[model samples]
Target: MLQTIHDLYDELERHRVMLSFQGPLSTDLITALLGAVERKMEGLEPDQRTRRRVFNVVMECLQNLFHHNANLTIHEGTTRTTDLPHGVVMIAQADQGYQVLTGNFMAGADVERLKGHLDRINALPPDQLREFYRETLADGTYSNKGGGGLGMIDIARKSGGKLEYGFVPYDKDKAFFSLNVNVTN
Candidate 1:
């Protein structure tokens, strides 16, 4: 376990990681995360615009994780246990920019639906993406969780790149979803 800790530290340093967290999320935790990240970016990202852009992307990602997170119920041969909606978030420096990455456990069945949503957002150009954002806002259609489906769109606009995402199967009916976005400084 101690060796694993050292290895993890080495890996984080190699990747230039500024901040990382893993576990269930809450409103209070999110607020704290924003504060911590804001302070870190203020020191490392001298450009105000770049800092704001990255900060906004991180906010959107955390909100999505908290609001749209999928709950899980584990079954161990008749022993049932429901677990909190867990997630992972990391911010790292890249050659061209800063990378914001998030991952969460989700139902495998929802993967196609989310994949379609992301692909559609990736397909639109910037001008059209802005238009679509306005359109979504005007339509005022919101999920049961009360978001207007704007998080991913906003992330794309702020990051100014295609959303990189994938799913890793966790079990017969569950999977882990990962999202990666980059903001240039």
Candidate 2:
């Protein structure tokens, strides 16, 4: 236990961000997270644009988590799954800017679809990205999963850079999806 805690501390120190939560996620928890981050940022002198970007990105990430996290429920006779997916969200101050990362477990097919969408969005030039976003919203193909697929595109465009992403196989049947966005000051 001591060694595990020590390792976690070392990892947090290296990343300049601390790992804090595990277990059920809820709206109140998300609000507390935003509050904690705001308090942390109070000591720093980040510019207005950087601060606003950070705030927007953080909210989007949290909302995505709330909507998509793996669901769990216990009933009288059986167990059931819900739409919400399990995930982690982290925000950190890096040398160039703030970095927001969210990770969750997903099925292989969903992971592939997400990757393709991310690749397509990342490939677009700013003008094309705007057009694509408008088209997506106008076309009404947003998945039952609740995102218009425009969120990732908008994040990429607004960040003025490519989105950083990674996928790691977590088990025989599950893979971890991570999305990273950087907002420069």
Q: What are the Cα lDDT values of the candidates?
A: 0.88, 0.74
lDDT computed for candidate 2: 0.74
Q: lDDT tens digits, residues 1-185, model 2? A: 99999998888878888334544566788898878767676666357676667767777777776665434334675744353346788777788887888877766557788889889988999999999989988997767766778778768866777899998987766687788888777
Query: Which residue runs does candidate 2 get wrong by more than 4 Å?
Result: 1-11, 18-20, 70-84, 171-173
TM-score on alpha carbons, each prediction = 0.89, 0.79
Q: In model 2, what is the error at residue 147, expressed in angstroms?
A: 3.1
lDDT per residue (tens digit) for residues 1-185 in model 1: 99999999999999999999998786789999999999999898889999999999999898888766566444565422245557899999999889999999787898998999899999999999999899988897888767678889999999999999999999987888999999976
Q: Which residue pairs come into collision in candidate 1?
A: none
For model 1, where is the 10-residue window of minimal lDDT?
Answer: 73-82
For model 2 the local lDDT of residue 5 reads: 95
